[model samples]
Target: MQDNLYDCPEYPLLLILSGPSGVGKDTVARMLIERRPDSFYFVVTATTRPPRDNERDGLDYFFVNFDEFAHMIETNELLEYAIVYNDYKGIPKQQIRDALASGRDVILRVDVQGAATVRHLIPNAISVFLTTRTEGGLVRRLHQRKQDTQEGMALRTATARQEMKRLAEFDYCVVNPEGRPEVAVERVLSIIDAAHCRTHQEPVRL
Candidate 1:
């Protein structure tokens, strides 16, 4: 009985959910946390970008000023940091360490660039690339936001196209169809389940 029980043991997973701008990465991550509240820990990213009206400081993002962001970088508090569209965005190292120590799977929602950095730091981490069904759909969604100027939109669209070509770097890619984030959430969960059942699961060390 003891030998049989040793055949399988669970190890916390570090799952990176990333994609190009305007692809529903945030939506999918939100639903994934809601679906498995107890088993998953959503990593709140730190950024210099100001929060929108509905976004909470720590909950939505760890909003900070440029100086403070620079201080974090100087002190090496970030697991991965990048200059994203003129703003500084990064993941806090402590949060991930604490969450993983608690035996909960950590979900990091980041841009494609940040994802690559994290993958390099934690090679065993599983990465999932979220994408729209088509490039046209992605552009349409960005335009629908109505928040960016024409030049800003054009830059984002061009960058997104380049990011799409990096899909082969990720372990899995999921299509997030318009208005259907739950479908993508289920797919992500399925991937986590499979990772746990791998024959030679390696413990994710920070």
Candidate 2:
């Protein structure tokens, strides 16, 4: 919890990447890490939602039941938490602190709502809102997921529209077109580089 931007480290930044569903936030972040595995640290969030096929605990997510999730919230173990589509999702506070202390830049792929909470908790964290080239493209991508029912899709689209209004809250925006995550990856890396090179910038005071 360092204050005074003058002493901030060039690396070990805690970045929050968020967007409405189907915007390919995860894909873009993955590509960025793949491009520099030694420099980026990916944090798997914790969730009350059950793991999908091939998903593993502590990897894809720290999958836990309602009781466990509640315990975390009660104990103030989560840096931020939100209920998305009726399931709980959160980022563990200690995990993020440990990652940053280890000297690796951390990337958190979080829901738009969860990201908002993180911005307050970590005032200096960089918030990037990822979006598709067009709103229609976002709808198409959500439909292609095949995991959502007709009702669920409708609900998601409505929620996404509401979420889009918060784009102004983010520090930066990156457009991730369908099937082209690398472009977004490079753009994000450039943002990080620019931030690091700035002579007078506030340090991330987490």
Candidate 3:
């Protein structure tokens, strides 16, 4: 066994979590924040979608309208942004930078496309791909949300199938089978622990 295993010294680490919609990405992220509130900072994404009931500004998302989103795109303020389900969603560079500089383990719950963009920008970032054991499970979870119509659910399922193909591109894959949110959270936490022990240069602060 290797001796003197490096202890991650409260340095900033960016953990990019991506997966198909309804694969429990948000659920896993929420658990992490709740379990280790001091150790991790959940990065809030900016979106053009109207906030749903019970969703608060700067919590669930940084809600914005179309015009503001378009202006952000024009100014290149977003590190990565994409139109998903006809709504603009993106990570703001300044928010990420600030979080990193503060030596917080910043976790981003983003789509596969946004994850890919983060990988390109921060090559050493830990990328975790969340997945469901089967397509049926994905469909079921989407339906449980009751936020989407039948047609919307169908579109999400179709999109999920396409996103699943990118699994190989991630560093690790965790299956949130049967919506076991705790299991998924543990798997991701294990990956984060393992990553901290690797012998690599410290990640760029922000």
Candidate 4:
């Protein structure tokens, strides 16, 4: 293993991963955390949406109600926040700072709008766009999830098309083809590895 030479007392690399709703962002993040839990810290977003059947409070999301979420925003505790389909979602500033202070690579999985917010807030941060190779593949995967009604699916598909147009704004784009999640994870890992080896040894000090 290669050593990080320019390692400061605390070096934090902020990576923002964004994709359309049904493009497997959570699945890819879970795989990375499972592979090397000690090396990376996955930031859990706070959301007003109630926990689903298998979702956990802190694991899947920091589930909060509307009033609590509103207080967080009013207190400026969130680095970035947005309303998605009537639910409020935000990333806490303290959680990100804590992760970075510990010299961990922090990965944030957010929507396209939230990712854009992060980019403006942290200009040096790395941004990646994840998408399916084809529209048909994306639709098929969404159908498999079985969580959306026909109308909901139509809305999501439309939103996905709009999200795809923002791909050019990202630093890197990874094509996540259908039924090949591991491949996508490996590709992202490879990108992270290369990023760490960049000629400029300075990590983004948040």
| Model 4: residue 167 alpha-carbon error in angstroms | 0.5
- lDDT, residue 110, candidate 3: 98
RMSD of 2: 4.7
Highest TM-score against the true fold, candidate: 1
Which residue pairs in model 2 clash with each other? none
Cα-based lDDT for every prediction: 0.93, 0.86, 0.87, 0.88
- lDDT for predicted candidate 1 compared with the true structure: 0.93
In model 3, residue pairs whose N, Cα or C atoms come closer than 3 Å (at least 3 residues apart or on different chains), thus clashing, are none
Among all windows of 10 consecutive residues in model 4, the one with the lowest summed lDDT is: 4-13
Model 3 per-residue lDDT tens digits across residues 115-143 = 99889988889999998888788878888
Tell me the TM-score of model 1: 0.96
Query: Any idea how many clashes model 1 has?
Result: 0
Q: Please tell me which predicted candidate would have the highest lDDT against the true structure.
A: 1
List the candidate numbers ranked by TM-score, top first.
1, 4, 2, 3
Question: Would you estimate the TM-scores of all the predictions?
Answer: 0.96, 0.91, 0.91, 0.92
Candidate 3 to truth, TM: 0.91
Q: Which ten residues in a row have the lowest lDDT in candidate 3?
A: 197-206
